[model samples]
Target: MNQFKKYPNFLIGFDRFFYRKEHKSTRRRILSIIVLILIALLVIYGILVATNVNRYAFLSLFTRGLRDQKQQQDFITNIGIFTLAGLSFGFAMQVKIFNIGISGQMLAGASFAFIITHYLAKTGFAPAVGGQLITIILSMFVAAFVSVLTGLFKIYLKINEVVSAILLNW
Candidate 1:
């Protein structure tokens, strides 16, 4: 078998990674897909390196993040937040609804928590652990309520979920 090498079309550089051919093999198709993805990633990395702009931002996080305690914690915190938001989106998907305003809901919860904490501090009744627990519980409710607005708009006003979500995101 001759090695497939050809000058790919400029408009579609991965055209050489052929999908439709006489050899109808799953392995060949998978290999072609993998090669296409690798070439795309290589192009991105090359551009990043050539420009000398925050090269380590994409390539060196494994060692650097572990070396710094604060960065490691921040990474873990972000993972947790993203995981929860992803799960929320997945759950919405099951219901044929798109919850694009998850971040807005999170912001609403954050605002609720901040206001509650500030008010308690002003009242001279700072109940640290209890206050935190209550804030968390109430914040969840606030966020859930914010999410419900999208549903309400869809149900009552017949607004598109995407439109309502973008509106709420603002």
Candidate 2:
């Protein structure tokens, strides 16, 4: 019914690429997404304006820690610690297990490590790297043992891990 009808392949391909072939459905979806994003931005802008916050430095908080060497080291250490915990959680989830005792296990391990470090410091091993390494290994084993204990209870006692973990966490 038109001149472009003679070149069906090119017209169909062009329409699909430009999103003009979906009866405005594709265009409407994109337009809605843009509108929602714009709305969110406007709300954030309004809150910032109402608070009279310094707009120029509002986002500097995110990068301020990187400006200090010690803070950067602390940030990286925290990242490493959290990544290990996250990996453990992911692994448990993959095996159809919910490891809600993670927090308890981590706290117990840290406390054990602190006690070991304190004793080492008192026994002339003050700041010894080897002692620190041993302390870390011991802490990891204690944590794993505690976590496995919780799993054992779930498997044998038929107790919900979440409920047991809540008690353990407390």
Candidate 3:
């Protein structure tokens, strides 16, 4: 029994080397080749960047100038709004609901938000920060609501979501 077990273990090792045809050296060589290719690609990219150093410098300067003038508060608010929109769409997808009217929903949401903001501004009851917050909240809510309504319509009316979504855009 001991001899039988030892013979099978030896044969397994032999099979790994000969039958399986996989060698440690071959694996090491493949790994080295991949590393070399990656290094070469990095070197080429560095050379290209160095050659166009001036052009890159000008582009960086132009972008930085624009960044300096952009309002930080507005940028933060926009990012928050977009994050909410993405989350809403992701949730819809998770529930096996298709939200093809995302673009139109977003457009209408923005338009409605603007209308609300202007109305509040005219009424003299809106603070600057408060108005912005309300606009962002309203935009996300309206957009998500519109997407849900479209999904419901598709399920209840047997209307194709794609056609309804496209027509909504028009």
Candidate 4:
């Protein structure tokens, strides 16, 4: 009987939590979520303990960024862009507007930024902040302009934003 072979609490706790009081547990919902998370961790650990390799693989994913500065910086930059995109999409979602052309907006904004920076570099006109603030402001304006076109497609052509977005994206 391996000490690690007989863990039933993870499964049993969840079964009990859900089926224990099926009809009257609204008040315990928050507590139940906490319990579920703890149980999930226990379940993940229990499954991973089957091999030392699994343990190493799981831990490596979390520690690699801490060990590599370049990887950490790349991760933050990529995540930051997606976070901004998500915020824009999420706000549109809240208003019941399905603006699926967000990608077009982002691409247009990036192009605008690239043009501004290229001009700044050519003209030898450098701002105190590396002209980054100007690039950001111009990018925002471009994105807003693209979004307005998307809205126009919706209102004037009665076209689905997704369709116009795909066209714009291309």
lDDT of each: 0.83, 0.81, 0.73, 0.83
Q: What lDDT does candidate 4 reach at residue 56? A: 73
Q: What is the TM-score of each candidate against the true structure?
A: 0.70, 0.64, 0.49, 0.63
User: lDDT per residue, candidate 2, 136-167, as tens digits?
Assistant: 99999999888877878788998899888778
Give model 3's clash tally: 0
Comparing 2 with 4 on TM-score, the higher-scoring candidate is: 2
Give me the candidate number with maximum TM-score: 1
Which regions of candidate 1 fall more than 4 Å away from where they truly are? 1-43, 50-57
Model 2 residue runs over 4 Å out of place are 1-58
In model 4, the Cα lDDT at residue 89 comes to 92
Model 3 C-alpha lDDT per residue in residues 24-89, reported as the tens digit of each score: 587756766687677876776677688876546644632444464465566667778789668867
For model 4, the stretches where C-alpha displacement exceeds 4 angstroms are 1-66
Per-candidate RMSD, Å: 6.6, 10.9, 13.3, 8.0
> Model 3 TM-score?
0.49
Candidate 4: lDDT over CA atoms? Answer: 0.83
**lDDT tens per residue, model 4, 67-125:** 67898898899889999999999999999988888888999999998888788789998
Give the per-residue Cα lDDT of candidate 2 at 96.
Answer: 90
**Model 3's lDDT to the true fold?**
0.73
Model 3, residue pairs in steric clash: none
